[model samples]
Target: MKSGEGRVCQNPWLNQGHTVEFSPDGKRLLVGSSGFDAVFEFDTDSGEVVWEWFAWDHGFDRSKLGHYVVRSEAKCKALEAMGHEVLLVDDPGKYEFGIPTRQKPAHLNSASYDSEGRILVTLFHQGAGYVVDRKTGDAQEVISGLINPHKLSRRKRGGYFISDTRRGKLIFIDENYRRTSEIALAGTPGIERSPQLSEYLQNTTELREELFACIDIHRSSLWLIDVKRRSYRGIKFPVEWSVHDVASLGRQHGLRIRGLVGTQFGKVAAFARQLKIIHHFSVDGCEVTALVLDSQDRQRQLDV
Candidate 1:
């Protein structure tokens, strides 16, 4: 795939549109922006905003102030112990708001589409996850107590699992809404765990246990973990300029298409992380909002 290939959702109040998901129908993209506290659907071919599904903003529901925007006080306490600021843990307005000092809206960090055509976003800093209504565009809290939720992954067996970046825990939720704490393979003995989390993904095999993850640190890297073998290896994915968000090519796809979501001004694009590059960000001059299409043809390749 070439640079500046399949790209869209270019600059329109996308301060923290860090997370992007392919539409269920594979014709659009759902971009979740923390800067705007909303998820807007963008036409893949046109790159035009179709509509937005806003996350709960400050004073969203005065009737139930803390309903949709709840946080894990315990998790916040842990992050505070980890050297995060007190105001950042409890009164999070300062994180986003600089002036009036109102509460910060739910920052939609990651997004996924359910079988019912609804978008599920990890409300990271908000300590919860919300499921958006396909028709009304409104959202309701479905998972809470998640500390700085980052990635939302659907399981092959029953339910779903989410990554808590701050706490370093992977929580599992069943179809019946039962929650259980889980440790990613990296946390186990002999397996290396990268600091500063970004995304977690498990392959859709019979066991549904092999995992893939990426670190959002300065020298960002990627990992492939085989739980059954109890072994893992790290790939030195070199990049000069920093990066923030990553989207996975489905497990079924033999092409390990991992797209880099360029924020803070750069091009959005996708490629296999295992590929080595001897180039710098200046080579492209930061053309944000372009990446490889998980095109139907590629999906067909995976299916074959």
Candidate 2:
């Protein structure tokens, strides 16, 4: 095995980089810090920090706001007793991963660039997403009440797709932050659970049993990243099979799909979570341009 040599920046603030993105021209890199409520810009070739933006200093407060409270007394008591304020609880131990906590207000989960060269970023605990003007340092809200938005992908027509991990739903919101459509994840065999609700009142097991497990999406199809089953699947539109049908077929084929990426030719590349690679028959008919691995270990590609 061979390891490639890369320059390592030892800055304490950026030591635990949660996300890294390349600038439009690929001349600079944007690093999101998990340890600090800040974003850092570094010169790719020089490894020098050219700019730093702090979310906390910009009138952002995490402690004052509260997450959605489920209507159930038992769950509410449990969460309250633990001092967990987030509405979504995807993973109790990893509260940050499942939902945003008050301790990390500017905990940015995902980011993307809009068509007009603006930067869009999502804050986990804050229950809001923002679009920042590159030249003016102005920020505008995109959406709210998202159950811990995990990722955001730019759409073809100047909009964006957001993944609400705790809710197991994908919402397509336009540039103005108005939701267009939402799709839930379909459950796989042996892994049946509905998306979590903030109101404890809606936390019934039957409600949780509705699996619409899709987590990500491209322009044409939605990617079913069933974390529970550790598999990937694809959902195509226009007379495609329902989620239940796809899950049934997956059980018969012995295929557990985890991540999906649309190719240039409109096909999807499915990846198995356990395998940590693309499935044998997952190759789509599109051209491959760029490959990226997100914070959740899902693979993504950019193609025409």
Candidate 3:
């Protein structure tokens, strides 16, 4: 074994970095910083911010994010004056990874580069999505009236898909951001139980065609929603009692789940819920293998 340490880049403005996206050419990194209520684009090589957009500059309330947005540099300078090595705090207990407890307004969770040098963003607290011009940092509200919108991704065929989390629906919108169709994960087929209304849809990724792998919190399962057919199939993952996000790793890599809680594969699963597991499933939704990570191992896994 060998020990290693290195310094890459540091930027005090990027607080609570929720979701990251890379440019198509892999030159720039787009970051959605919820704490600062801003989205930023950083050069991959130099680690310098090339473009930035602040929600408060648009229509976001300044009261919710003014502290972080205004005093970020001063706070970092104060910490530096105190001889502190790191400006940003990377504590799991402080940040509450995999939990949606932070209640900052304009909590930008996801950011991605869209066509024609425009970027897409989803603000969970604001319940809206925006399309921003990369050059001018001008934002246009594309979709609104959502409840805790998660990921807004462009479909391969056409149009776009958004995970309206609190509403437990996978919403599809056209290029103009008009609501075309939506599939309610809670009301999806195979759910015979009465509507407990516990379904919280999280990260959604296009699997193939119209099928999408959606993270449903009800049974900690993946609800494969078919957009065209308006149908769904629930793949019950009992090992992990709380699944957070799901993604298709492609036809070669299959499907991967970013789960929050997990237990052993047995009847006493309820008793053992301390483990964090990452399950790899086949494209067909069958469990391929499970890797359980204990506390001593890696503390966090990147959301795929």
* RMSD values, in order shown: 14.0, 16.2, 9.8
**What is the C-alpha lDDT profile of model 3 across 215-236, one tens digit per residue?**
7765467777676797767787
User: Per-residue alpha-carbon lDDT of model 2 for 25-102, expressed as tens digits?
Assistant: 766777666444556777767778876655554655334554433424566577678887734322234322322234
TM per candidate comes to 0.56, 0.50, 0.62
lDDT (0 to 1) per candidate: 0.51, 0.49, 0.65
lDDT of 3 at 147: 88
lDDT of 1 by residue, 1-304 (tens): 2333555466445555566666656678777666546577788778888766655432231111232232346644665676654322234343332211123445556666766767777765567776677787777677888666765656656577776655545567787556864655334332222345433332111223445354423233444545457665655544443445444546544243335422243332333432212222444464433323232111111121
Candidate 1 C-alpha error for residue 48, in Å = 2.8
RMSD score of candidate 1 (Å): 14.0
Candidate 1 global lDDT: 0.51
Q: Cα deviation in Å at residue 29, candidate 1?
A: 0.9
Say what the RMSD of model 2 is.
16.2
